[model samples]
Target chain A: MAAARKKETFWSEPISKVDLQRPAVVPSGTSIIDAVKEMKYNQIGCVLVVGADQKIIGLLSNGDLMHEYVGSTLPGDTPVDTIMTENPFTATPALTVQEALEIFHSNPFRHMPILNGEAIEGILSIRGLMVFISEHLPLEVMNLPPDSSLIATHAAGE
Target chain B: MEGLKEYLTRQDFVSSSEVRWCPGCGDYAVLNSVQNVLPQLGLPKEKFVFVSGIGCSSRFPYYLDTYGFHSIHGRAPTIATGVKVANPELSVWVVTGDGDGLSIGGNHLVHALRRNLDMNIILLNNRIYGLTKGQYSPTSRKGQITKTSPYGVLEEPLDPLRIALASEATFVGRAVDTDPKHITEVLVAGAEHKGTAFVEILQSCVIFNKNAWTEVSDRSCREDRLLYLEQGKPLIFGEKRNKGIILKGTKPVVVTIGEQGIKKKDLVVHDRHREDPVYAAMLTKMDYPDYPLPVGIFHAMEKPVYEVELVKQIKEVTALKGRRNLQGLLRGSEYWTVSNKGKTIKRSTGISSLANDESKVMDERIHALLKSTDPLTASLKNTIGKIFYDYDYKRSKMLSPRDSIASAIALFKAAKIECILVGDAKRLYGILSERDIIQNVVLTSVDRDRMPISSIMRPVYEIMDESNSIGDVINILSISGHRHVPIRLKDGGFGLVTIRQILRFIHDTVEQVEKKESEDK
Candidate 1:
């Protein structure tokens, strides 16, 4: 008899499997304008405000800036810490992508800072996880073209 | 005016938040195309506002840096209307999906389009509910099966472009997500239009309803399946550009240009600006297999913008009324003032008036009736034994410690009581109340079906003596939050005293006092 196959789960995959990019990091006292410039240059959604020890103190996103200071009287040179979310949720490299996805879904955030014992590792993004999952999906689904024959008229449920 | 400020680029419109749509979703292309086209419209970034209802396509506002409103489900059009009416200078854009617009906000969409407001409305038609996860939408084809419609949808799909034309939209167009260049051009044209411009973009969900527009969007076959409509040109399509649509007695027929001797002039000429919508409506009905789907502007005409007209009317009325104050307008002609003595004074400036004496009489009578029903407190000095015996203690359910929580709950429901006594009458074990069941059994992971009552019941060995005053029971109940407490009867029988008994005593006392007062009067 053939050995029973072990079922694989999509969410339980390790975070390392995701194509994480180096996170954009700004000093705690960095101006909002400069921090935004770094974010724009890096082509990332957010930047991690780190203390002198290189530990994440807060995280700032485009949404935070737009809501708090975009059209407000606050000057462009204001410290980014004033608008950053203090003690943002962080996950370690050992965490599963499912746990990261849950954090992203529950909160209005699109990016999360990955850590390795107080050391900044990389940023795990929802888009990155989606790309990883898409690559792992069956080619028939990932590369599906608009074809009438592939359309299912009835649900697979019996 | 154009050279004063630097021209905005596509990057200026791109938001910092990550575009979280699924990979290969057609929304990404649409977002990119809009971001690219908005810079060319010569409007400041702050002047544009994107309003969206709830759905996957509604996330368009978040991906843009412009001032946007993520409104409630199926209400994007109403919110957009309000935004535009409040500030006609702002360029408002309403983004909605098939489910959000056609299914729930259908009335708002039709009316908004019919009014011909100076704004842009983009309907991302994927023909499926993507955000709620795989449900058939109002635009889902008949006989198409989805999570909600297991046997297949029985309703005919709604054509958004046809609806736009029916609503008398000033500008109506269609685009496909796969063709980003075309979407950009159509969006720019819609944005520049003076009145309401409704564009229906056929996109793919990639997850729930993947490849929904494959026939018209697939790159390998799109050219042969789609006819790009241009003004003054014949409706010609197909890979070789030989196939053309010719009107045959109000019906469109696909004919070969050379083989059938059907010259270009013999085909139907695309004239989108025609005053009548019959030609545009015909273009909207063309579909795959029999006819190539039309993909450009189906109709465009000049109309009086609703917002501009509304502002003009408001200004005219203000001038005619000579700027009347709100107070004077509200108190126009006459109004009444009710005094503390219940007398309603009728007053009118240079007009007739009559007093409403009947209302005053009814008010005074209601006040007098309310004053007679003041609450009378019960005597707390009454002995616990007196109240316990009157409570009909025999009705209190008694169960064994081995009884399941389910049985205890059943007994509580059957007896219409909040608590049940555990153990025999002679030997008291504990008291099990609904609060205990909810707090410990129901809310916890413990199984109510198999778990014994003893697991959640409160052990109550300190029984109140019958000779104790009612005030002492009240004190104990208030301090411990206990709904029911055991009592040792004077006759050496076990009984239960509940908080409901005290409330009943108070109510009866108040009723007796009221009766006596009435009789004396």
Candidate 2:
């Protein structure tokens, strides 16, 4: 099973190749509570806040909602922009997962927006990135040749 | 699970809060209907939450005995959304008025509908702001006079039903507050619906907009003006059942039944299950005087509700990917762990090499200052337990993490203290020393407005303990190069000690020695 599993470099793959969230987008001036509801309802990781022209302005996640609303005294009625991380650090669609790793180093972003010029392509969550990398990394790093290694065998499926 | 009789009663949902609405207000009827319908939900009273925005009708939550939140104006839908999303099991309800829901909260309302969350929304269309005494509302009729539009309302009035229809709300209905049975029926249906249910109540504001809906809702004219929609039935109304609606190529034509070859078969059949929404849209647009008003469910269709989809998606994603916890996200990176012999071993791989900037040296300095401290320092031993108490110590002021770094820096300069304790309005966080600020803010050139004081706070363990003598304090000031020594007070508060204070003590002792030596000479 270990021999059957394919090994891949995390940095070499473009972020677009990995599943990026087709974000549930909400308009600016939207309340934080409503924005979070949109994210929860759609099961979307992040709700991208867009301007009047539908350009990305901000983004809110479960973590942001927890910190900004659940932990704070601010009412849920506060506008999305008020709690949303405005103009968050974004990566271009052409950027690789390795580049994403480097970007995370500086920005510490768990969820990074992928932009194709002015328009948003999708969102990349650290969970998705790490999970994908973990599947590929476990076997090769162990350096044990093929056959029934329990951890490697379990991670054999793509 | 709960017993039916234990948590199910109309009185169980009644709140102790004083009912403050004006007597004869339409809100009273809607409130009664909600309380009655709640018992039928079969959920515990604690599982129910009524959220309302600012307005006369927004006060509905306060009168409810169950958990409720009186939220901001025009933001009830948003608040209710939090309550529902955080705990989908909770039967969340939104109570909002015409001005609060339509005018100020229109964005939240439409989005909530579009999302099709599993929650009931009771929109009270009173046509005026009764709380503010008298003001025209968004649903107020065109050419109506009020405090805001005394010259008569110029803009065409908004139709709440039409808005709900366009937003693709799963359940949309209208009922009159004057009719308790009808209101209860609609409210129960809304509560029973698995998706977002919007019911607009045509409530009469006795003081501000008196009899706004009385023309259509009055007993004498109700049979003719009001049209009760029933599934798979012909569109018929009027006291004698004489009036019937027939489609003239999409336009509804009100004609007399059993006259001019107009039979019941010729009437348009109400198709609640129609895939197309043109009929529902038209039905919602119908108004009194010209057309009989629709006072039942205009549209109720099955759609995958938002909360359900969210939960399903999360499960699917979690299965596909892996679990990501909150703490990993907070400190800004995923903490890698390896299972060894059934025990998890955490790896200390930081987020990229970029974080190791020039601050690496300062980080080492900080670690040394914090870790190298022993229980007893050579500078002072017994002096702390006895003599140091005689010296007056200044307690440092604390700042909340929410405060901007710029304001904290300005405050630090004015306070003349080398450092300040950083925390909330209460509670003592780590101390923020001038050295920590100079290293992170000035040397690194970070954004002060965006940065929080918590980011550069000196750890509590690094602080000088009350047991340390003045000698130990001086040693700390020299080694750490911090003018201010934030010490823990005996009462569990934070106090500051400065090099200037120590210098003053030294100068006074030297003066005393010189006078004694001169007298002996």
Candidate 3:
């Protein structure tokens, strides 16, 4: 339990230091073909549309694609705005990692838009944090400490 | 002598709630000592209310015949303050522990003492949260190994008496429950004293933190290891009665009287009335094996009490201004507009937006939000993060099957829940629900309080996972009629979801559709 442990404010780290790997961006009228192709190439989970002033007006994650577009009656070139969650929760580059994490953890939606006063700065995906953790802590078995006497035993030598 | 017959008896203070602490717990002695003193105080039984926070000791209210409120963990003082303020005639006694008083309730305890509220705070210092089975409490000594602190607790334990003294508590005392006579003396003084009388009772938890007070509690060594303080009397203790405490500047030194020319006159005499708190602080700070632990009143002085002063202030304020009745107060320049039918009427608050129809619709949105169901179910994937409800197991009122059916009823009634898990911290053996009780209990002639929950427990049917769709949940609920269902935790533990949440989804979907159609019209 890290109740007593001091948590690092990872969000305070500059946006430049954050992984800015381009989350696929497409225009409103872009066909699903282009969005899918971009996702396949970049191996990213979602796409966002930036309006004229580079403001994020809408988003389309894989959840929207699978839950609605895949099996339903929507046309491929239908505008992304028609399907995206309106007035979605967002964050700013200046947000503390604690605040960002709270937003990420609190919501069912995973992808969050990082803004610079309504202008899209970038997008921070929950996967980015996971990747950051996995990189620091590799997926290898953590060996126990070498004190062999620490193992559970009977009160007597037997 | 003439008023002897008017004095209330101990039997009158006994309540019907069974005293459920473990056998041999020091709490039994302390409870008897308190009940013994209450009658002697000459206050009517109705004048006394024992308020306690969560701990083994917090159950004091249930066993008492007097009116009591069993408050939440560490916040008994807050409720007691409300009770005292509302009715200044009542005598409030707070029963808290090291965990409840120092750890979580520390903030409330500090303010209550500092304000010098008219109440008696009897802190049971067992140095552990015994109810939670054995976890290192805030007062647990450093390097004390416990369930939570397996490697050993690293934080230094708190000294509650010292804190009480530091918090400007008007009267502070200490007693070891092992010494029954001494406990009675301390509790009597605690009840008589006005303002906050903080008494720390050093008690033993036989199961955990056992023998913590052995030096002063054990019969063989207690005489030498504990010093009972008396005003104007030189402190003396030990098997031979030859040992005495002498002051070396501010520090107290244990000296064997008549050894090396040490005389009883040279020893420190307790001055309970000393205005300064330094003497009390020093007495409370003394540790065992160095200086004998000081018991009995450490400090006793008077200050203007919070309740008395508040009442006086209210009276003074009313005299200074005019007394307005409820109707006049409500009608004080506030405006309201009402129309029965199609006619438009305007009575201005002048801020007018509140009267606007659009704002009314926005208010409806807030209502919808309040009644808004969770958009998603507790599925195989993580949905919402944990909340107060998710920690129900930790907060749930649990009982062993062998525990009295009365305890189960009390717990269920207090929590206002449909069921309670029957077991200990280790595992849930089964759950007892209202359905089980109704189907099995009231129909039969079983004695309600004596009946065991085991006879009526319904085993948990099954565990649900996040992968279960809302439809799957609906089907399960329809077939089994289980109101509450356990779900797999995202972090490998377990969580719970209730049918209420599923029903909320259906309600929210209907409301959303209704809103859409309304907007279109």
Candidate 4:
């Protein structure tokens, strides 16, 4: 039965096949403001936190920053680690694409750090994964149900 | 036939002006497509006139090697109508953006389309105002984020195709900028249409609002998302051409071809030339995701072309009236010219000689003269102050610079006044009017709630002294292109003198003159 298996599907492929981007990383002691600037400059949705010895410590997403710093009394110089999610769910390079998708589907976080025995590889965003999959099955990518936002509820007039 | 060199080429349509649109902008593709299509139309390059309103897309006229008019915002349709009406032989084309065409220009566009003028109007809809730096435009999708709509747009977007169909546009089509070949085809078809041909191009402003038509323009999904309407083809779409749309009890339903015994004939046929636009209007509502966005001519019906009919009417009238000239109309048969030797005017002699004759005959002659003469001409020499008092003109209230534009607009709306003096009664600064708002504030990035009235107020250029005659007021008003003028009072203040007030004064004088003439009889 094992020998009868013809070809491996896209879901059974290694996580590396998804081509995860090199995650934007900042030192644990970096300021929240600096982290946000890095995220904006890199045009990424989140930044990964690393402690001394270059081990992944936490993950700071735009949503995390928005909920933690925005409209709050926290000073710009406040450390990012205070607001970041510690021990974030991570994937391994050896993990199958299906495993990564399952983690994203079950978890609330949008970004997952890819780790290779504490030596960081990259980050895998749910959107990035979806885009990769869409390239394979382009037709099914946009075959979504109607978005309510597209429909005009009221007359467009003054 | 003339030599091949005599015919125009695509190179002939390229202008010397440098294309200044942002790199990767959809307008570049559209411009190229238009240039390619024009040479194929077989018309003289000089006969084409491209009129545009204000926007990034409005810059199309400068890049095209033809007669072009970059008219004012939202007035391109009106100017294009005039261009077509005046020169029916010329092929007129109006280029406008979503903000320019669907917002302030909405009324003009509707009228122009409904009139069925022999012109082509291209509306480049990028969903956002790229010229104004990404403000929510009239076609921007609800919940779409922009500079002005940081929290996302609240109002529903206006569908340009639906509006055109509703306006009874003789030719209405849609095309995306990404597909240059398709756009060129649609444009050629539109140019060939005899009546008003309105095409809304789904363009992308790469810098401000990128991928605005991604659902329909993206190479990966375009085949599945866009339904290319052929003249007699059935409405079908999808990568495999398996999914088709069928009308079920007035609602369009997507069905599989072979799954439930549905065939190609069951799909809605493309009937663009159908007289009634009800079917075409339904196609406009079939947007992306739920259904394929229909492109190509959604509706095309033969109608009496405005310019052709107008020229015909003018010709018929001229034949009936024996071609009367302007000089003949201006100078009636009863004109009296006084000689240089101080001779008595012919008409004036009649008035004097009538006194010598019967009083009833004098009254009759005066009444006849009054009928022929303009009543306003007699009051033109009267001082503006006297006219103002005679007409009981109300003093226009002055607004300060500190007032918000919103408040100024409110004042204009509530008071139903054309203009307001932007200063106190003591010192004059400038004037803010509805015209100023329309020309400056509307469709611009100016925040009416935050910006002060002084920001848009025009400095008073034409000022008339209260002692100045009404004749002087008319001269100033005509030269300044303003409907109202500020009258400087002798008591160190200003008064608003309007053309309406002057006309009212003339009307009252005419009534009095007529009453006096009847009393004499």
Instruction: Count clashes in each candidate, considering only residues at least 3 apart in sequence or on different chains.
Output: 0, 3, 4, 0
Better of 1 and 2 by DockQ: 2
Candidate 3: which docking quality band? incorrect
What would the per-residue lDDT of candidate 4 be over residues B206-313, giving only the tens digit for each residue? 987886898688989898999999999988888999888899988998888988889998998889989888899899999888888999999998989988888889
lDDT of 3 by residue, B1-521 (tens): 33642667888787777889888899998998887787888777778888888999999999989888889999998889888889888989899999999988999999889988888999999888899999989788889888999999999888998889889999999998888889989888877788989999999898898876876788888888889888778888888889988889998888998889999898888899999998888888887888888899989998999999998997996887645466754554435455788344444443332225554555555444323133222121122223213434453356888897767766655565555667665555677765455334323446767878887787777655554444444444444546556554455444455543433343344346558769999
Give the local distance difference test score of model 4: 0.78
Q: What is each candidate's DockQ, to 2 decimals?
A: 0.01, 0.01, 0.02, 0.00
Candidate 3 accuracy as TM-score: 0.49
Better of 2 and 3 by TM-score: 2
lDDT (CA) for every model shown?
Answer: 0.78, 0.73, 0.70, 0.78
Sort order, lDDT high to low: 1, 4, 2, 3
Clashing pairs in 2: A11-A98, A41-B306, B15-B65
Cα lDDT, model 2, residue B240: 96
Q: How accurate is candidate 3 locally (lDDT)?
A: 0.70
Candidate achieving the largest DockQ: 3
Candidate 1 Cα deviation (angstroms), residue A73: 99
What are the TM-scores, per candidate, against the unseen true structure? 0.50, 0.50, 0.49, 0.49
Candidate with better TM-score, 1 vs 4: 1
Model 1 chain B: which ten-residue window has the lowest total lDDT?
A: B369-378
